[model samples]
Structure formats: structure tokens, C-alpha cells
Target: MRIGYFLSSEEYTPAELIEQAKGAERAGFSALWISDHYHPWVDAQGQSAFVWSIIGALSQATTLPITTAVTCPTVRIHPAVIAQAAATSAVLTGGTFRLGVGTGEALNEHIFGDAWPEAEIRLDMLEEAIHIMRELWKGGVVSHHGKHYTVENARVYTLPEQPIEVLISGFGPKAVDLAARIGEGFVSVAPDAEMVQRFRSGGGNSRTCQGGFKAAFATSEEEGARIAYEKWPNAGVPGELSQVLPSPKHFEQASQLVTQDMVKKAFVCGNDPEAHLAMIDTYAKAGFDEIYVANSGPHYQGLFDMYAHSVLPKL
Candidate 1:
């Protein structure tokens, strides 16, 4: 399995981001998936840096490939803007960047006072946006008027060595099917055998799977849970409900009903080396070509070391 690291945009500043990216590369991680959220989920999470700039800096910081875990092009930013941004990033990275995109969240998309579109509409918008981006990326003057976007007489001057790959992310079956038809790759938080199968059945290649999971590591399990529930109480929202509840408070409220046992089932929360490796293996077994670990809380350096000694050697 190819191993990668998922960085919380809120958690790291540019210098810290570079240090972590370099560390992951040295530690033998294959690639990096950074998030692009305009707002931190909530202040509990503390920060969400503008992602495009970070990708630009990371191009210089490391040689490992980078992909946005998912950026929403339909709502706040036009696809034309995202196309130009992705093209520029690909050039800066010398063709190592992939633009991973998705139908986004109300939390991020609604911040600009635009109502979040329904899932079906968002999917439609994404398809149209992808069409627009592709035309713009071909390095020629383009005129496009899609149902969701328009661009006229535009061309990317700083061309990439190649076109940026588009990776799509989605959790549900319909969305997964949509990705399979349109994406060069697919990304998801949890690896499910059925979801992988569904993607394959719907047109995604067997080789095009990437999965990520969060693991909490602290000196104390108590410290880890405290941090976990404090920063990500909404995490326990299972299945489709994560689609409806729109605020951090909803997560906090739903989380109050979540037990430590429940949280345990969802993440690796202790410092055990064997335990961490086991957590990573579960996703690999489910058919992920790439497995990304989202390091939890703080103490990132130690978490990386622990994984290197115990978790990584096993993988």
C-alpha cells in the first residue's frame, strides 16, 4: 500500500506545513493530501488556512506528490478560478499535483451567503465545472458556457508539464458512482469493501482507490479523547446524517450521546505501536491503493515516529 499523510489545514501554518511534509517524505510516505476549507469547521478546531497558497509553498518544500483532498468548485469559487489555480499549482510542482475536488459542505460553501445546493444539484454543478476546467487547462483560448459556469477567451500561460489529474471524493453510493464515471481517482475517509466494489462496478478502475482514517495519539488516552471530542464531536455522525446536520453544535450535541466505546470503534486513540499498524492494515485490506493517516491532536512529531517504528514497518 502507498502511505500518505493528511494534514488538517487548520492545524498547521506554512512553516509547520513544510516541516510536516518534509518529514513525511523522509519517512517514506508516497504522497500528501491537504485540505482546502475556507473556514475552520469551528473555532474548536482553531484554523483553516487558505489552501491554494499552501500548495504553492509545498511545491518548493517537498518532492512528494500533493492533492487537495477535496475542493468545492461550484459554490463560492468559480470553476474557471479553480482551473487556473490547479493549472498554476501543477506547473509549480512540476506536474506532481492533482486537483481533488468534491461537492462541498454548507459550512464552507455557505459562508459566502450562497445557499448550499442539494446533493444532486451539487453533483451536476461539479460535472459542469469539471468540463469547464478541462477546457481551460488545454492551454488554448477557450469559450465555455455550461449550465453552471462560463469562461471566455481565457488561456493558461504557465502550462503544466501535463494536465492535472482530477480525483473525486464522496461517501455515498450515488456520489461514488458519479466519481467513478468522471474521476481519474477516488478518495474517501473510511475504507469500506462494499464502497470499493461499488465504485468498481460503476466504472472506477480497481487501481484508483485512496482511503484515509483519523488516529488520536497523546501521552494519555484521556488527553486524546478530551481533544477528540472537544475538537471533533460531530465526527461520530454516522452514515447519511452527516449530510444534514450543518453546524459544529450539531456534532457537539450528537457527540454528547456518543460513548468512549463508540469513539474507540471509529479511531485508534492510544499510543500502542501494534494498535496503530492494525488500524492502517484495516484500510489496506479493504483495497486502498493509498492509505492516509490524519494524525490527531498535537505531538505530531512523536506520532510520526511511533508510526515509523511500529506502524509503518508492518505496512
Candidate 2:
């Protein structure tokens, strides 16, 4: 399995983010996965830059391949526009970019005053969006009409040497099957083995699969839990339900239910080298083509340093 790095979009400044990307590449990570967000889920998570711009910056900063952990092409931005952006980015990055996409949430999508689409509608949108993007990248005029969208003749001018690979983010069975049928790669963060199996059964090939686990690392486990709750209260599962609920306060409220112990189980926390190495191994055993880990709390450099100096050496 290849080791990869994941960055929380809100966690660092653009310059810091670029530096971190370089650090990870130097540390020998095979690739980089960065979150795409327009707004921080809460005031606490704190910064969201235009992810495409950041992807461009990282392309210059490091050689590590970059992927949007998942970007919603159908909602905030038209797939045609995203197609141009992805194509240009891949060409600039020397074909080092992968278009990791998913049906997004109200947080980013609602910005355009567009109604938040339901799961079924989102999936439908995703299918059509993928079609639009792929065709545009083929380097000629293309137009598309589908249940959720219609495009006039459009073509991306600056294309990449290689066609970009599309990775679909999926969680449940229906989503998994769709990813299998359409996506070149499957992306997930949940530790569930069944999700991977379902993804494969649903038509997901023996292609690249990327999965991540998060941890709140600190000197004290109590401090770790506090940080975990602050950053991500909803730790156990993944989906859009938590997003549509009622308020940002609800996420903070739900976060209160998550304990440090729960976060620890999900991620190998603390300064222990063995613990971190084991966490990496667990994902490898789960058949992940790439395993990504992100630090939930501060001590970002510590975690990166640990991973590079000790854990990466061992791996």
C-alpha cells in the first residue's frame, strides 16, 4: 500500500499548506489529498481557500500527486467549468492531478442559492457531471443534456497530456455501486471493511482506492479528546445527514457525544511510533491502495515529523 497525506482545508494558511505539501512529498508520501471547502463547517475549523487555487499552488510547491479528497462538480460550479479547471490543473501539474468528486452538501452548494439536492438527485447529478467532464477533456466541442443539466457546445482548450483519472467518494451500498460502475477509483474515510467489499462488488474494479482515518494527537489523551470534539464531534460515521440537520450548533452538540476514546480507536493517536505504524498497517490490511492520515489537533509539524522520521522509515 502507498502512504499518502491528507490536509484539512481549514486548518492552515495557504503558504503553510504549500509548505506542508512539500514536507509530505519530501517525507516520501506517494500522493496528497486536500479537502475542498468554501466555508468552514463551524467557526472553529477556520479557513477555506478556493481549493483549485491551492491545488495549483501545490503543483508548483511539490511533486506529490494531488487529488481533491472530493469536490462537488455539479452544484456550486458547473461540471464544464470544473472540467476546464481540472484539465488545466493536470496539464500544469504534469498529469499529477486526480479529479476526486462526490455529491456535495448545503455548506458549499447553497452558496449559489441553489436548492440542496437530495441523495438520489445528487447521484443523478454526479453521473451527468462525470459525463460532461470526460467529454470536455477529450479536446473538442461537446454538449450534453441530462435530467439535472444541459450544456451548450463546450470544449476545454488547455488539455493535459493524459486524461485525468476520476475517483468517486462513496459510503453506502447504492453510492458504492455507482462508484464501481463509473469511477476509476473509490474514496472513503470509514474504517469499515464491508464498504470496500461493497464498492468492489458494485463494479468498483481492482483500481486505486483511497481511505483515511483521523486522529487528535496531543501529549494527554484528555487533551486529545478535547481537540477531537472541538474539530470533529461526529467521528464514527460519514454522510450528509449530519450536515443537513439543523444548525452548526448541532455539529458542536453532536461532537460533545464523541469521546477521546472513540477518536483514539478511529485513529492511532499520541506520540507513540508503534501506534502510528500500526494504524498505517491496519489500513493496508484492509486492502486500501492508499492510506491517508490527518492530524485533528495542533502539533501538525510533530505529527508530520513523527511520520517522516520514525514511522515512515519503518514502513
Candidate 3:
């Protein structure tokens, strides 16, 4: 499997993100995955750079391909605007940009005081938004009047030589089916073989499947776990709470129930190259074509060095 680095916009400033992108490229990572968030999950992560602005900077800073580990076009931003931004990004990156989209969390999409749609409704809106974006990318005046959105004589002027590949992120069966039906590729954060098989058998055959996992690098495993829990306790927030929580404070409140061990279980703690390789193998065995690893603390350079010297060489 191809190994890539995931840049956490929620945790890094714009300059930091660009530096990480450059570092990843130098460390021999194959690609990049950057998260799109309007707010840090619990404010301990502490930074949320505008993803498009960072993407523009990243294009100049590095040659590796980049994807928005997921952007939500259904709300917060209109699909039309996202289509234009993505087109410009693709062009800026010399056609190395792939738009990864999903039915977004309420934390980001509910900022306009819009009522959070249920999962089914959000999926429907996502389908419509994907259709509209794809239409706009065709280089014509698109006038879409769908059930959830409307576009009036819209066209994406700045486009790449090819239509930008759209990778859909899905965690459930219904969403996976939709991705299989419409998306050029699939994205997920889990190493679930069943879901990967479901996606392929459901019509995603031969499409790229990307998975990601988080790591917290430190001198010792316990120190790494402490850092992860302090910064990303929400990693242990179970069920639909992650999707439905509307604010950082709300997430902070919910995350109080999450234990440090829970967060540790979710992250690959410490600088053990074997642990990193085991995580990569898990994703590979689950049928992912590519895997992105994200670090959650100040020791990202340590993680990168480990990958370059020990982890990546073995792979």
C-alpha cells in the first residue's frame, strides 16, 4: 500500500501545515491528506486554518498530491463555491488535487444556525451536491435545480485538464453505497474489511480506497498517550456524538467521559516503527490501496523521521 501523511488543520497553524507538507514530501511520503474543519474538536487542538488557503500554499511548498481528507459541500459552503475552489486547486496543483467529500459533522455545518439534517437527509443533500459539482466541472454553464440545492448558470472557469477526481468518505452502509455509485474513490479512517468489501462489491470495483489513522509521537508510549488525551480526547467520543455535536464546548463536555486509555487505543502512541508498520499492515490487509498517518502532537518531525528511517524503508 502507498503510505502518505495526513496534515491535521485542526491542530496546526497555516505555516506549520505548509512546513509539514514539505517535510512529508522530503520524507518520501507518496501523498497528503488535510482535514477541513471550521473549529478544533475540543479547542485543545487549537488551530483551524482555512483549508483552501492552506491548499494554495501547499501547492507552492510541495509536489506531493493532496486531498481534503473530507470537505463538506452540503452546508457551511455552497457546492458551487466549493466546485470553483476545487477547480482552482486542481489547476494550482497541476492536476494533483482530489476532492474528498462527506456528509459533514454538525460542528462545522451548523454554524449558520441551520438545523442539522438527519443522516438520510444529509446523504441525499450530499448526493445532490456531488451531482452539481460534477456538472460544473464539465466546463459548461450548469443550471441545477435539485431538491436540496439550486445553481443558476454556473460554470467553473478555472479547471484542470481533467475533471477533478471526487473521493467520498463514508462510515456506514448507505453512505458507502452512495460512494460506490458516484464517487471516483473511497476514503475512511477505519481498517474495516467488511466495509471495504461492501464498497467494492456494491460497485466501487477497482477504485482507490484510502484509510487514515492517528499517531502521537513521543519518547515513551505513556507520554504519547498523555499528549493524545490532552489534545484529542474526542477521539474516544463514541457513536453519533461526533457527528451531532455542534460546538467545541459541547465536544469538550462530551469528551470528559473519555479516558486516556480510550484515546490511547485509538492512536498509535510512541515512536515504535513496528507499531506504525502494524497499523499500516492492518489497513493494507483490510484492502486499502493507500493509507495516511496523522500525528497529534508537537513531535510530528519525530514521527516523520521515524517513517523516513525505519517505517517507510521496510514498506
Alpha-carbon local distance difference test for all models? 0.80, 0.80, 0.95
What root-mean-square deviation over C-alphas does model 2 reach? Answer: 2.0
Q: Lowest lDDT 10-mer window, candidate 1?
A: 240-249
Residue lDDT tens for model 1, 1-315: 788998888666777878888888877778999988876555677778889999988998899889898898988798989999999999888898988999988767776677767899999999999988888888889898777777888887777978788989888887788888988888888869888888877898764788888777888767776666666665676765555456666656666777766666677676777776776778878878888887757777877887677677777
Q: Which ten residues in a row have the lowest lDDT in candidate 3?
A: 154-163
Most accurate candidate by lDDT: 3
Q: Give stretches of model 1 more than 4 Å off.
A: 239-241, 244-260
TM-score of each: 0.93, 0.93, 0.99
Cα deviation of 223 in candidate 2 (Å)?
2.9
For candidate 1, what's the RMSD? 1.9
How far is each candidate from the true structure, as Cα RMSD in Å?
1.9, 2.0, 0.6
| Model 3 root-mean-square deviation | 0.6
Candidate 2's residue-wise lDDT over 107-142, tens digit each? 677776777877888888999999999999989999
Q: Per-residue lDDT of 67-127 in model 3, one digit per residue for the tens?
A: 9999999999999999999999999999999999999999999999999999999999999
* Residue pair clashes in candidate 3: none
